[model samples]
Each structure stands twice: as structure tokens, then as C-alpha cells.
Target: MLPFRFIHAADLHLDSPFAGMSGLTDRVRKHLQQSTFIALDRMVQLAVREKVDFVVISGDVYDSSNTSLRAQLRFMEALEMLDREHIPVFIIHGNHDPLDSPRLAVTLPPLVHVFGPVPESVTVVRRRDGQEVSVITGMSYLTSKVKENISLRYNKKAGASELFHIGLLHANVDGNQEHETYAPCSKKDLNTAGYHYWALGHIHSRRTLQESPYIVYPGNIQGRNIRETGPKGCYLVDVDETGAVAMDFRELDTVRWFDMEVSIGDCRHPEDLRLNVERLLTDISESYTTGFSMVRIRITGRGSIHRELEDGFILEDLLIDLRRKVDNQAGTVGFAGCVWVESFCLSSGAEIQLETLLQEDSFIGELLRLAETELAGDIGSDSVIGHALRPLMDQPEIRLLLTGSTREEQREWLRRAMELTALLLLDDQEAGGASA
Candidate 1:
């Protein structure tokens, strides 16, 4: 048996529009809109540069079934580049771009082989010897939803022992809760299939579950949102003559996404907070070579600025000022090329510590205890404060907000409310004292 090299990529999701984005400059928006194509182009370039024998796209070449003509043209151009170089491409459609999809109307090059609905094997011969070297067994999604365990149908053992066998699938393996359960199958199901390598798709986070008989998800070639943050790319896999397999990840994303939490526990004044924010943005910019990045920051921990942040006006003004500072530093040294803040949150608590105040035997302390009891449900639903929010909580939107919320999160919210109320009262007292 001879050694071979190939790329296993999936979830191209071409021409996917950014979701829940705001405050973008026209220049940034343009780059984002074309990021998917840019990522795919880089993959093709990598394939050519590395001189791999063939390329395997596990699934989701397009964003949806009704993919735009522009997307199709761009995809064709990339594949054509490989075709001109005499490199072959194997593809299988996932639930996003099923076999019956109307968007697959565009014609592709001869070197491209798209697998059909049923599990079937296609043998490729080594160009050097004209002898069969590898067999690729795959199946495409016929419809949008395949509830059955489709892995049961793959028959890789039908191939001869001397050939390398590869299995391609776009399924929700082992009931991955992050993604919709489409074409569900267990890891055991794939392992038992007796393939040398299993190329998987549908979940957009890369994982190499097994090394002996590589079961891999190369993730999506592009990260479309914050949830899909970090490096996005494919796997360059090499199989040696002795059947030893090795895989290396190659990053293809032009724009990187990051979420950071900046603590303001020691920030005693607004200027102190401003300096802290400036430091954070400056540090983040220099951390990545990608140059362009999207960031979401949460300002957390107890601080003197908590009351001001809760006032809304101060937070809005602070955000505007922070953006101005960041915009001025775009393309400058010690900063990511063009960094954009998606949104910010003030999760800070008041300077007055809640734990210390809880120990007092006073009216305010009693109120704090009551609030904590209601928050923890220690005061049952029969209590006055428990029923106070019951009607509001009954609303559909409110219930939706509470859905999947942990007890810690609920308690945290309650603590924030108590802190805010106490701060307001203290501010009122100070005003009264000054007037007197």
C-alpha cells in the first residue's frame, strides 16, 4: 500500500449572512459578507499549495437549499482551480444542502464527484501505478431531516484489504446537543463500520475523537457568529505506507471572534474604568495575527462605578467614548487590525459588599435577608414577595427569558436588583443630608 495526502473539510456554509450584528462600518460589513468565500478560497489555495492528492468536503457546501447563484459561481470557480491542477474533489451534501435541493442546479467540473443518497463506494486509483489505492464510501442527505441512524447502511468492508477506506457523513453523532439531531448515530456506529477514516459534519466544532481509525469533524470553514468563535479551518490528513495516519489543522478564517470579560473590581472612578477598558482593547488587538476581530466584553465584579453603570446613561456614554478610542487605534500597533465591540454588559456589583451588610441586625439587613430568601425560594410561593413577581413571570416573554436559567443565574439577578435598590436609597440619603 502507498501513502497518500488529502484534505477533509466540511460546513463551508457559503455566503452565510452575519446574524445579530450592529454598529458596523461599511468597510467592516463588506469584509464580513465575503468572509465565507474568502475562507473557502484559502482552503482551495491550501490544497493546491500542499499538493494533496484529493479533497473531501463532508457536507454543507452552501448556506441553504436555495443558495444564491453568486455562491454557486464562487464554489465552481474554487473547484475549477483544483480541476485545472488535475486534483480530484469528493463531496456529499448534508441536511443544509440535500441531494434534492433546487439550489444544486449549477454544473460542476468533471473532477468533482458528488456522492448520492444511498451509501456507495467509489474507488480511486493511484495515478502513478493505475492500481486501486483508496475507496471512499459516502451518502448525501436526500431530504432536510433524516431521523434514522443512517450509519447502519454504510458498508466499507466490501472493499479489498489492500485499499484505504474512507467514510463521509453529515450526521449528529452521539446526540450532540449543540446541533439539531439530524441523521443521529453513535461513535460506536462509525467505529464499527471498519473505515480507515470517518469524515463528519453538522456540528461546527472540530474534534478528533479517535486517532487509530480517525473519526474527525473539521468544523465549519468559517465562524458565522460568536457561538462559533475561535479558529475555523480544515484538516490536512496523511496516511503512510504502513497505514499510520496523521492530521494537522489549517486555519482559514479571515475574521476572528472573541469574547472577553474585563473585571473592574478595583476601579474606583470612571476614569479608572476608562483606563482599564483602553488597556483591554490595546492588549486584545496585539494578541492575534488575523488583524480583524469581533469582540464582546462583559464588565464584571464589584466596583465603585456600579451605580453609574446601572443608571444606563453613564454606560451608554462610556460605550461611545470607548468605541471612539478603539476606532482611532484600528490598524495601529498593539491592537488587532480592526477590532469591533459587538456589545457590552455591566455585571458589576455595588462597592458596598452584600455579605458584610447581611450580618447586621438592622432594617436594611432584614430587607436584604428577605430578598435573598425570595431569590432562593426559601420564602415559599405563599409569601408576599414571592407572589410579587409571579404575575410578571407568567408572561410568555418573561418565561422564555427564565427558560434554561440555573439557580445561580436567578440568584445573581436577584442580588443585582438588591444592590441597585440599596445604591439608589443611599444616593437619596446623601442628597438629603447635603440639602439639610
Candidate 2:
């Protein structure tokens, strides 16, 4: 067998709009909107530059079944570029972009092969070339919800011993709770399967579960939100003549997302907090000098600013100020590039003793006590607090982000929220001003 190289990527979710953020400059928004396409373009450029034999995208090319024309056209153009370079592309649709879903009328290049609903194998072949045959076998989603274990259906197709076999699938392995249980299977199932490599998708976090047979998920090409933060990209897999595989992760995101918590435990005033935020923004900007940053600034730990932030409008005002005084300046990312504060949260606690407050006999005390009992009951979703979170949990994508949260975590948050609510309701203007 001859040594060959290829790029592996998945979970494009192209044209997916970024949301739940504010104070975004016009230029930042524009950069965010084009980030997905830029990521794909980078992948194609990498494929051509590395001279890879083939490219494999495990699944979820579009964010929805009703794929946008812009996403389709951009994806098509990337394929055309690879076609010109004579690099083959193999893709399979996941739960988000199933085989039964309707898409715009756009045709891809001949070098692109989109796998069908059932498990099937396709060979990597180019005319006037002499190399051992390698096959890519994959299956796509028939519908958005696939619960049955379909990994059992795949096997190394009856072919010559010299052929290299690669398995591709967009499924949940071993019931990973962070994502919906779709096309669930165990690692053992994949281990027993007679394939040289398993390309997996459906989980948005890149993971390489096995190295001997090379089971991998390249994650989404772009991080769409704070929950999907940090560097996002694909894997450039190089295989030796002996079929030994080595993978190198290449970052391709044009806009990075960040959620940073700045603790004011030792701070006394708002000015101190401002200095901390400036330092954070500087670090974020320096870390990703080549692109833009969408940051969610969370102010945590006990501080005198807690009482001031209880006004609700104070947080809003701080958010506006952060945007104006934030990186790049005047609604533009300058030549040096910068970060934008997408959202602001004041999760800081009051300097007053929590135990003293909880022991009180007032409405605030009762509220805090109930937060640990009735509010945290099993009928949480039916309660007021749960009702408020219903909207976020209703959306599949947002729910997926919350899927990892446990009841204890929710209860702890409920207590903190109740504490903040109690502070907001009280008109204590001087209780914590000693530190302010």
C-alpha cells in the first residue's frame, strides 16, 4: 500500500445564525455570518495544499432540512475547487441534514459523493493512477431521528486483501448523554467491525476514541456559539504505506467564541472589575490575533458591585459600555483585529453573609428556603423557574447544550438565582457600600 493523505471533517451546520447575544458591531456580525463558509473554504484549501487523495465529511452539512441557497452554493463551490484539484470528497448527511430532507436544487461536482440512507461502500479511484484500492463505506440519516443501532450493518466489503477499508457514520456511540440518542451504538460494535478507520459524527466535540483502528470525530468545523467555544476545525489525516495513521488538527474558524468568568473576590469597586475585563479582552485578542472573538463576560464571586448590579438596568448599562469601550473601537475590527463582548452576566454575590440572610424570617428568607425545596422538586419544569427555562430547552440545539447539566447543578443555580432575586427586591442601598 502507498502512503496517502486526506482531510476528515463533520458537523458543518452551514448558514446557522449566531444568536442569544447583544452589543455586536456590524462588522462583527458580518464576520460571524461568513465564518461557516470561511471554515469550509479553509478545509478545501487544506485538501488541495496537502495534496490529499480524498476528503471525508461524516455528517450534518446544513443546520436544517430547509438548507439555505447560500450554504448550498458555498458548499458546491468548495467541492468544485477540490474537483479541479482531482481530490475526491465523500459526505454523509446526519440528523440535521437527513437523506429525506428537502434541499434547494443545487448540484455538486462529479468528484463529490454523498452517501445514501443505507450503508454502502464506494471506492476511491482516479484514472491513470497506480495504487492499492481503498474504499470508504458510510450511511446517512433517513430521518432526523434515528434510534436504532445501525452500526451492526456495516462490514468490510468482500474485496481484495490489499484494499484499505474506512467506515463512516453519523451516530451516537455508547449513549453519549450530551447529544440526542440517535443511531446509538457501542464502541465494541465498531471495534468488532472489520474496518481500518471509523469516521464518526453527531457529537459536536472532536474525540478520537480509538487509535489502532482510528475511530474519530472531527467535530464541527466552526463553533456557532459560546457553548461550542474555543478553536474549531478539521483533521488532516496522513496514512503511511503500512496504513499507520497520524492526524493533525488544523484550525479554520474565522470568528472564535469565548465564555470567560472574571472573579472579583479581591476587588472592592467597579473600576477594579473594569481593569479585570480589559485584561481578559487583551488576552483573548492576543490569543486569536488572526480572527475575531465573540465573548460572554461573566462577573462572578462576592463583590460590592453585586448590590449595584441588582438594578437590572445596571447590567444593561455595563453591557453597553463594554461594547463601546471594547476592542477594535467604533464598530470595526481594526488591522490588529479584536474581540466583541457579545453578552454580559453579573453572577457576583453580595459581601453580606449568606447564612445570616438565609436565617432571617422575612420574604427573602422564605424565598431562599423554598428554592432548595419546592422549586427544586421533580415538577421543576411546571414551576415558575422551570417555565422560564422551557423556552431554551424547547429548542433542540439549545437543549443539546443543556443536556449535560444535572439536577444538582440546576438546584445550585436555583439557589443563586433566588439570592439574586432577593437582593433585587430589597432596597438595601448601603448594606454593601462599605466596600464600594
Candidate 3:
């Protein structure tokens, strides 16, 4: 067996319409939209630099079947670079971009090959030296919904004297519950397929189902939301002359998504908390000077400023100020990319004692007791929460906003409402006592 190296990438998701972002500057939004294309370019650049024999994308080359012309043109442009270097590119469409869907009349380069619906094998041959000993077997989805176990259909090509064999698939192996069970299969199916390596896709998180034959998912090229956080990229697999394999994971994301929880438990003032958040943002911006950061900041722990933050307008002001600071820093010489706060969630609790309030013979105590009874289901459907929230749930416009549907979830909502009501009652009592 001769030594060979190839790049394995999947879920490119080009021309993805990034949602949940509003009130962003034109520059920032433009950068967010171009992120996927940038990631693909980076992968192509890496392949050229490493001088890999070939590149295989398991599935999901585009976000949808109606992929934009810009995405198609950019994809072709990237592959053209690989073709110029004599590097072969193999691709298979996933559920997102099946063959049955309507697509633009876009053509690929001479060295590029897209696998059809039926299982087929293509041997990778080097143009300079005629070596076709490495065979790759793969198939694409004909339609968007593939409930069949496609991996079971793949088998090693017969009568092929190939030195190395690879299986390329975009499927949910072992019914990974996180994603839709399209083209589902199992580890046993792949392990017994007689392929030296399996390159997989569909799941957005990287994982290795088995190491013996190396069944791996390179994840997505770039994350589109906060749920898909951290570094996103592909794999570089190198097969040694002795058939021993070494795989290297590479980061190709141009815009990285991050989720951060900042604790203000030790801060005595709002100024202190502001400084802490600013400092953290500065560190992240300086660290990833080449890429943009979309961060979701969650404030946690008890703090004196918790009451102030509950005012709603204060949080809006804080977000505005933080974004202004980020924009200002972008003007600095070293800032190649800037950080944008996707959302600011306040989970900080108040510092008041709640046990004493529940014992009082006043409005706060009455409300708290009612909340406890309803939460325990002592009042049943006629409970205060049930009556008050029933109308809101009945309204079609507001129904979508209330996502919590379970009993425990209802209890949590009631509990939070009671806490806020108690705070107001306490303030009112203090004011009455001062006048009397």
C-alpha cells in the first residue's frame, strides 16, 4: 500500500440565511452573510497548501436546493483552484440539496465528480503519476427525505485491486437524536462494510463513531447559530505507506459563535460589572484578531445591580453601550474583526431574603402562598396562574411566544412572577412605613 492524503469536509451550508440577528450595522450583517463562503475558501486554500491528493465532501454543500447564484459561483471558483493544482474533488448531496429539488444550471470543473443516488465507486488517480489504487464509494440523496438506511446499501467494489478504500456518506448513524433521522444507519453497518475509512456528515457536531476503520463526522464548515458554538471545520486524513492513518482536524470558520456566562457575584457596583464584561470582550477580540465573534452574553449570580437590571430599559442601555465600545475598538489598528452581541440574557437573582416574606400577613405573603399552592397543583386548573395565563394562551398571536408547556415549566413561570411581585410589595411597605 502506498502513502496518500486527502481532505474530508462536510456540511458546507453555503448561502445560509442567518436568522435572529436584527439592528446590526450593514458592515457586520454583510460579514455574517459572507461567512460560509469564506469558510469554503479557507478549506480550499488549505488543500492547496497541504498539496493533498484529493478532497471529499460528504454532503450538504449548500444550505438549500435553491442555492443562490453567488454561492454556486463561489463554490465553483473554489473548486477551480483545486483543479488547477490537479487535485480531485468528490461530492455527494445531502437531504438539504437532493437531486430531485430544483437547482440552477451550474457546472463543475473537469476534476470534480458528484455521486448519484445509487451507490457507486470511483478510484482516485493522480494525474502526474497514474496511480488508481485508492477507491472511494459514495451516494447522494435523490429527494429531501431519506428514511432508508443508506449505509447498508454500500459495499466494496468487486474485482477492484485498490490499495485503499473509503466510504463517503451523509447519514445519522445510530439514530443520533439531536438531528433528524434521515438516512439512518448503525455502527455495525459501517464497521463491517470493508472500507478502510468512513467520512460522514449530517450531524453538526464532530464525533468519531469508531476508530478502527475511522468512521468520522467533520461536522459543519461554519456554525449558523448559538446552538452550534465553538470552532467549526474539517479533517485532514493522511494514510501512511504502511496503511496506518493519521487524521488532523482544522478550523475553517470565518465567523465564530460563542456563548458566555459572566458572573457579577463579586462586583459591588454596576460600573464594576460593566468593566468586567468589557475586559472579557477585549480579550476575545484580541485573541481572534482574524475572525468575527457573535457572542450571547448571559449575566448570572446574585448582585446588588440585579434589581436595576430587571428594569428592562437598563439592559437595553447596557447592550447599546457595549456595542458602541466594540465598534470603537474596531477602529483601532489591530482589529481585523469585531465582536457583536447576539443577545444579553439576565439571570441574576435579587439579594432579598424570601423565607421571611412568605411568613408575613400581608400582600406579599398572600401572593407567595397562592403561588406555592398552584405550583403544587392544590388549586388545579382554577388556580390563579391558570386563569391569568389561559387568555394569553388562547390568543393566537401570543401563543407562539410562550414555549414552556409542561407542569414544571408553568411552576417556574409562576415562581418568577411571584418573586417580582414580592419585590414591589416590599418597596411599597417601606414607603408606607416612612410616611406613618
Cα lDDT tens digits, model 2, 169-225, are 998888888889989998899989878889898888888988878889888999998
Query: For each candidate, what is the lDDT?
Result: 0.83, 0.81, 0.84
Q: Could you tell me which residue pairs clash in candidate 1?
A: 285-335, 285-336, 291-337
Error of 2 at 37 (Å): 0.4
**Model 2 bad stretches (over 4 Å):** 125-128, 325-336, 354-409, 417-436
In candidate 2, residue 406 scores what lDDT?
Answer: 75
Off by over 4 Å in 3: 126-128, 328-337, 353-388, 403-415, 421-436
| Tens digit per residue, CA lDDT, model 1, 198-259 | 99989999998787688899999988888888889999988889888889999998878888
lDDT of 3 at 398: 70
Q: Estimate each model's TM-score.
A: 0.87, 0.84, 0.87
Q: Whose lDDT is greatest here?
A: 3
